[model samples]
Target: MKLIRGLQNLQRAGIDSASGCVLTIGNFDGVHRGHQALLTRAVELAERYGVPATVLSFEPTPREYFSGERAPARVSNLCTKLLDLGSFGIGQVVLHRFGSAFAQLEATVFVRDVLASQLGVRAIVIGDDFRFGARRAGDLEMLRREGARLGFEVDGIASVCAEGLRCSSTALRDALAVPDLTHCEALLGRPYRLVGRVRGGLRLGRTLGMPTANVNLRRQPALRLGVYAVEARALNSDGTGGEFLPGVANLGVRPTLGLTRCLLETHLIDHSEDLYGRLLEVRFRQFLRPEQRFDDLSALSAQMQRDKSDAAAFFASKSTGPA
Candidate 1:
C-alpha cells in the first residue's frame, strides 16, 4: 500500500513504473458501499486484464475547494482512507491536490495528463453519474470520448443500494446525523471512524478517576453532541500491538466544567496509560446518550459511572475485550 502524498512528490520519483492499471476515480469521502462497488469493478477488471488495481482520489477533497471553506465532518480522515483502501487489496493510489490549478483544468486536460500520461490507465471505472474537472463539468460521456482518443477504455458502474435506498455518502452522513452506527456500517462496509492526534486536555477526567485521552477534530462537523459508546484503538507507545479499548466518549464542550472549546474525551474501561502526543483512531460503534450538564461535580461523576456501566454491558455483549 503505497501512499503518494502529492503530485510533485509522485513525479519526483523520475517515472511512474505502473505501466498498466485498472483505475477508478472519485472523492471517495466515506468510501461507502457505492464507492466499494466501483473499486470492486476496478479490482475485477484488473484481475481480468492482468493489471494493478489503482485508485485516484483528490486531497483537500473537491468539495472543500468548491465550498471555499473547511470540509464538513469527514466520515474518514486521510489515514483511515489509506487503511480502508489497503484492506480492499488496492496496490497503488494517486492523491492529486484539488487546488485552484488542478481544479481549473479542463475535462480533457485531466484525462490526458492524469489518466493517460501519468497513470497509463488501461481501463477506467467510475459511477454512472460521476463527474470531474473544472466546475465538475466532466461526465461519463466526456470520459468515454477521452477514452477513445487516449486509447483507454471506460466502464460506468450503477448505484449500489441496500433496503431500497441508494447507498451514498450523503445518506451515510444523514445516518450519522442521528448517530446511527448500525445503518452507517451497512452503508460504509465498516464502522464510521475519526482519526486525530491525542492532545492534552484539562485533566478533569483524571480528577474523576477516569483519565481520558483527548482527540481534537481538525475540521469539526455537526455531529450529534452526546456521550457515545465507542470502540477505540490506542497506538502503543513502543509501537507494538495496537490496543483496542472499549470506552465511553463525550463529544461536546464540557458545559458542567464551563469549557468553551469542543473536546472528545474517552475513558477507557480498565486501562490506564499516558497517551499525550500520540495518534489515536476512534471508531464509533454506537451512540449511548446525549451529553447533559450536571448541576455539580458530584452529579457529573455519578453520570460518568453510569456511562461506564453501559459501556461495560455493550462490550460484554460483543465478547471482545480491550485490545
Candidate 2:
C-alpha cells in the first residue's frame, strides 16, 4: 500500500483529484473488529466506484496531542497500525501529524478544504459517533450535510460488537489490561501483538543466560506489565514473510533493574540466532505473572527459568491437543 505522509504530499503523490477515492478517517488505533467492519465497507464502496480504498489517519493521534501524558495507552504504534491497515486491503494511507494548528481547524473548513478539495474523497465511511474539527464540533449529521452539498457519499457504520461486547479500541484496551488474551482475540479478530525492531540492550539477559531480543517501545502500551507465553516472528525488510517461533516474553519497565523505560524482551525457546535490527512481531498467548522486583539477580534468574519452562509447556499442550 502507498503511504502519503501528509496533505501537502497528496498532490505530489499523483492522486488524481478528479478521479477521487473511497475514504475512511480515524486513528484506527488497534485496527480491531469495529475498524475492520468500516474498512470492509470502504473497500466495497471503492470497488463499486472504481476508486482506491484510502485511509486518512493521524500520527501522535489527537488524544496524544491534546492529553499528553494522560492520553490512553496505545494498542498499536504507527508501524503496527500501518501493517494492519495494509493487511486489510487498504490501498493508500494519508498520515497527518496532529498539532495545535490542525486541532483548531473548523468543521466546515475541514470538510471542504481537507476532505473534498485536498483528498478528492468520493465516499467516506466512519463510525456514527465520530467527532472532528475545532472543539470537536463535527458530527455525523454535519458530515452528511456536507457530503450532500459537496457531491460525495457518507456512510456511518454502527459500532460492531463481538461476544456481546462492543468491538472498540477502548474495549480492547480493557481486555489487555486484564491480560485476558481470549477476549482480546475476540475483540481484535486476531491475537494482540506488539511489533518493533530488535535493538541492542545492556546484555543483562545474556549474563543471566536468557539472551533476549530487546524491542524498544515508543508509546505506552495498554498491555498489562507481565511475563507471557508468546510467539514471535522476524519480518523481512519489506515487512512480510516470517515463520513464527514459540517464546517467552516480558513486557515491563524492569523495576528490578531500576530501569524506568518500558521494553519488550523475548527469548526464543530452543532457538538461537541474531535478530538485531529485524522487525519482530510478538503475539501474546498467556499471561504468566505480573512484573515484580526480585530481591536479587539469583531470584530473578530463577524466575526467568521458570517462565521459560511455563511457556514451553504451554506450546507443548497446544501441539499435543486436548486430552
Candidate 3:
C-alpha cells in the first residue's frame, strides 16, 4: 500500500493532493472489527467517487506520548496494523508523527491544512467518539462545519460490539492480559496475532535444545508472561503470503536468565530454517502456563520439553475446549 508519511511528504508527491479521496482517521491500534467497519465505509465511498480510500493515523499514538510507560499495551505493532489495513483493501495510508509540536496545532489549521487542502478528502469516516487537534478541540461538529465550506463529506460511525462488549483495542488488550484469546478471536474475526522481524538473540534456546526465533513485541506489553500454544506462519511476501507452521512459544522475560525486558521466543514444530532478519507471524491459540524461575538450566530445559509435549498433544487431538 502507498504511504504518505507527513504533510511535507504529501505536498512533495506531485500528485494532486486535492484529487477526489475518501479518508478515515484514528490510532486504529488493533484494526479490530470496529475499525474494519469504519474503513469499509470509507472504501465504499471511495469506490462510489472513483477515488482512493486513505487511512490517516499517527505514530507514537497519542496515548503512548501522553502516558509514557503507562500507555496501554499495543494489540498490534505497525507491521501488523498495516497488514490488517491492506487486507481491508485500503488504497493508501498517511502516518503523521505525533509529538509536542504536532500536538499544539490549532484545530482549524488541522482541518484546513491537513484534511481539506492536503488530502482533498471527498469524504471522511470515523467513530462517533473521535476527537482531534490541540487540547482535544476537534469532533464530529468540527468536521461538519469544515465539510460545509470544504466541499467534502463527514461521517461518524457507531462502535461495534460482541458478547455485550464494545469491540476496541483496549478490550482486546484486556482479553490478552487474561490470556483468553478465544474471546479475542471472536471479537477480531480471527486469532490475536503478533508479527515482527526475527532478530538475532543469545542463542540460549538452542542450548536448552528448543531453539527459538526471537522477535520484538513492539510496546510496553499488556499480555501476561507465559507459555502459549500457538501457530506460526512464514510470510512469502510483505506479510500477505501465508505458510502456517504449528508451534509453541514463550512470551516473557527469562527471570532465570536475569533478563529484564520481555521477548517472544518461539520454536517451530518439525521445521528449522534460518529465520534471522525475516518477518513471521505467531497466533495465540490458547494459554499454556505461567512463566516461573527454575533452579537451573536443566530444570528450565525440562519444563520446555513438557511444553513441547503439551503442544503436540493439543494439535494431535485437535481438541478445542468448552465453547
Candidate 4:
C-alpha cells in the first residue's frame, strides 16, 4: 500500500482528479469491525470500478483539532491506523491535515473541491451516521446528493454489532476503560493492541532487575491505566512479520516515579534483547491490576515479580487449552 501524506502529494503521485479512486473517509480510529465493514464495501466497489481502494483520513482528527486537550482518548495513532488500513487491502491512503482552514470548509465545497476534484473519488463508502464538513453539516443524504451531481457512487454501511452492541470506536473505548479485554476483542474482531517505536527510558526497570522496552504514547490512549498480561513483538521494517513474546506490561503515567506522561513499558518474561528504536506491538491479554503508587523501589520490585508470574500463568493457561 502507498501513503500520500497530503492533498498536494496526490497530484505529484499521478493520482489526480483524472485517476479516479473508490474512497472511504473517516478517522478510522482502531479500524474496528464497523470500520472494517465500510472498508470491505469500499474495496468491493473499487474492484468493480477498476480503481484503487483508497482511504482518506485526517491527522489530529476533527475532534482532536476542535477539542484540543479535551478530545476523547485515541484508539489508535496514525501509524497503527495506516497499518490496519493496509492489512485490510487498501491500495492507497491520503492523510490530510485537519486544521482551522479545512475545518471551516463548507459541505458543498468539500464535496466538489476535495472529494471530486482533488481526490477523484469515483465511489465513496461511509457509515450510515457519518457526517462531515463545517460544523458537520454534511450527512449521508448530502453525500449521496453530491455524488449524484458529480457522477460518482455513494454507499453507506449500517453499523456493525458485536453481541448486540454497536461496534464503534466509542464502544471500544468504553470497554477498554472497563479494562475488559474480552469485550474489546469482540468489538475489534481481535485483541486490543498498541503499536509504537521503543524509546529509551530512565532505566528504573533495569535497576530493579526488570528491564523494559518503553513505548511513548503521544496522544491520550483509550486504554485504562493498569498493568496487564501482554504479548509483544518487534515488527519488521514494514510493520509486519514478528513472533510474539509473552510479557507483562504497565500502561500508565508512573505515579510512583512522579512521571506525568503516559507510557507503555513491557518486560519480556524470558526473552531479552535490545529493542530500542524497533516498532513494537503489544497486545493486552488480561487486566492484572490498576496502576497504583508504591512506597519505594523495593515494594515496586516485589509487585513487578508477581505481575510477571501472573502473566506467565495466563500464557500457560492459553497454551494448555480448556480442560
Candidate 5:
C-alpha cells in the first residue's frame, strides 16, 4: 500500500495523488467491523467511479495527540492498523499528522487544500461521529455544503453493531479491558492480538528456569495487568507465518523489582530459543491472575510454574480462537 505522508506529498504528486479516490477518514484505531463496513462502502464507490479507494486517518490519532500520557490504550498500533486496511483491499492511505499546527487549520481550508485540490477526492464517506478542523468545527453538514463547491459528494454510514454491541474502537478497547477476547473477535471480526518486536530481557526468567520473550508495549496496554493464557508466534521476515507456541504471558510492571514500566513477558511452554529482534504476535486467551508482588523470588518462581500449568489446561480446554 502507498503511504501518503502529508499534504506536501499529496500536492507534489498532483491530482493523481491517489488517482482521484473515493475516501473515508477516521482514526480506525482497530479497523473493527464498523470500520470494515465503512471501507467496504468506499471500495464499492471507488469501483463505481473507476478510481482508487483511499483512507485518510491521523497519526498519533487526534485522541492520542490531545490526551497525551492520559490517552486511552491503543488496540492496534499504526502498523497493525495499516495491515488491516490492506487486508480490506485499500491500497492508499492519507496519514495526516495531527500536531499543534495541523490542528489549527480552519475547516474549509483543510477540505479545499487537502481533500479537494491535493487528492481530487471523488467522494467522502464518514461516520456519524466524525469531527475535524480548528477547535473541531467540521461536521457532515459542512462537508456536504462544501461538496457543492468542491464537486465531491459525502455519505455517512450508520455504525455497525452485533448482538446489541456497537462496533467501535472504544467498545473494542473496553472488551480488551475485560479481556473478553471472544467479544473482541466478534466486534473486530478477528481475534485480539498484540504485535511487537521481541527485545532482550533481564534474563531473570531464565535464572528462574522460565525463559521469556520480553515485548515492549508501545502504548498503555489495553488489557488489564495480569497473568494470561496466550498463544505466541513469531512473524517471518515477510510478515507471514510462524510456529505457534502455547504460552503464558505477564503484562504489568515487574513489581518485585520495583520497576514501574509495564511490559509483556511471555514464556513458551516447551520451546526455548533466542527471540531478540524477532517480531512476535501474542494472542491472549484468558486472564489468569491479577499482577501482584510476591514476598520473595521463591514465591514468584513457584507461582510462574502454576501459571504455566494453567496455560496448558486453558489450551487443552479451548481452541486458540478465544477463551
Candidate 6:
C-alpha cells in the first residue's frame, strides 16, 4: 500500500490521476470497530465502482490541532493505524495535515475543492455522526447534497455499537484506562498497541538484575500508569523484519528510581541484546497491577520476579500473536 503524506505527496502521485477512488475521511485514531465498519463499506464501494479504496485521515488529528496543548492521549498513532489499515486491505492512505487553514474551509469549498477536485473521490464513506469543515458544518446531509452536486456517491454507516455501548476511539480510550484488552479487542478488532522507539535508559533494571529496553511512546493524556503483561516486538537491525518477544512492562514515573516522567520499561523474557537506538513496539495484552513504591530494592526485585512469572503464564495461556 502507498502512503501519501501531505499535499505535495498527493500532488506528486497525481491525485487528479485517481479519478474514481472511494475515500473515507476522519481521524481514524483507534481504527475501532466503527471505523472498521466504515472502511469495509468503503472497500465494497471501491469494488462495486472499480476504483481505488483510500483513507484520508489527518496528522495530529483535528482535536489535537485545535487544542491549545497536546490533545488527550491517542489510542493509536499514524504508523500503527497504517499497519492496521494495510491488514484491512486499504489500497492507499492520504494523510492530510489538519490545521487552522484546512479547518477553516467552508463545507462546500472542502467538498468541491478537496474531495472532488483534488482527490477525485467517486464516493465518500463516513460514520453517521461524522462532521467536518468550518466549525464542523459538514454533516451527512451536507455530504449527501454535495455528492449529488458533484456527481459522487456518499455512504454514511451507522456507528457500531456493542453491549449497549457505542464503539469509538473515545470509548476505547476509557476501556484502555482499565487496561481492558478483551474489550479493547472487541472494539478495535485487535489488541491495543503502544509503539515508540527504544532509547537508552538509566540501567536501574540492570542494577536490579533485570535489564529493560526503554520505549518512548507518543505523549498521551489519561495513559494508565501501571505494570502490565505485554507482548513486545522490535524491528530487526537489518530492517528486514520484526521479532516478537513475551515481556512484562512498567509504565510510570519510576518512583523507585526517583524519576518523575512517565516512561515504559520492558524486559523481554529469555532474550538480551543491546538495543540502544531501535524502535520497539509493545502491545499491552493485559494489566497485571498498578505502579507502587516498594520498601526497597529487595522487595521490588521479588515483585518483578512474580510479575515475570505472571507474564510468562499469560503468554503461555494465549496464542502468540501480535498481543
* Candidate 4 vs 6: which has more TM-score: 4
lDDT of 4 by residue, 64-99 (tens): 898988889988777688888888889999998988
TM-score of model number 1 = 0.85
lDDT of 3 by residue, 119-205 (tens): 888899989998988999999988899898888899889999988899998898888889778888878988888888899999989
Residue-by-residue lDDT tens digits, candidate 6, 130-248: 89889888899989998998899998899788666899888888987877778888887667776666788788789888899997656643447888888787764322246678899
Best-performing candidate as measured by lDDT: 2
Task: Pick out the ten consecutive residues of candidate 2 with the lowest summed lDDT.
Answer: 314-323
Clashes in predicted model 3: 0
On the 0 to 100 scale, the lDDT of residue 57 in model 2 is 93
Q: Which ten residues in a row are the worst by lDDT in model 5?
A: 10-19
> Over 4 Å off in model 4, which ranges?
320-323
Task: TM-score each candidate.
Answer: 0.85, 0.95, 0.94, 0.95, 0.89, 0.86
Model 6 vs. true fold: TM: 0.86
lDDT at residue 320 of model 1 (Cα atoms): 57
What value of lDDT does candidate 3 attain over all alpha carbons?
Answer: 0.84
Name the Cα RMSD for model 3: 2.2
Assess each prediction's global lDDT (C-alpha) against the native. 0.79, 0.91, 0.84, 0.90, 0.84, 0.81
Candidate structures ordered by TM-score, highest first: 4, 2, 3, 5, 6, 1
Clashing pairs in 4: none
- Least accurate stretch of 10 residues (summed lDDT) in model 3? 11-20
How do the residues 1-323 of candidate 2 rate in per-residue lDDT, one tens digit apiece? Answer: 99999888988998856868999999998999999999999999999999999999997789989999888999877788888998888999999999898999999999999899988999999999999999999999999999999999999999999999988999989999997999999999899988898999999999999999999888669999999999998986556856789899999999999999999999999889999989998889999999999999999999999999999899888965211
- Per-candidate clashes, comma-separated: 1, 0, 0, 0, 0, 1
Tell me which residue pairs clash in candidate 3: none
Worst lDDT window (10 residues) for model 4?
314-323
Candidate 5, residues 1-323, lDDT tens digits: the string is 67788756775644363568899998888889999989998999988898878998887788879889888988876656776787787868878788998889999998998788777899888988778899999998999999888799899888899769899988988988887878998998877777778888798999999999998766656778899998888886445766678899999998998888878899998887688998887877788999999989999999999999999898888755333
Of 4 and 5, the candidate ranking higher by TM-score: 4
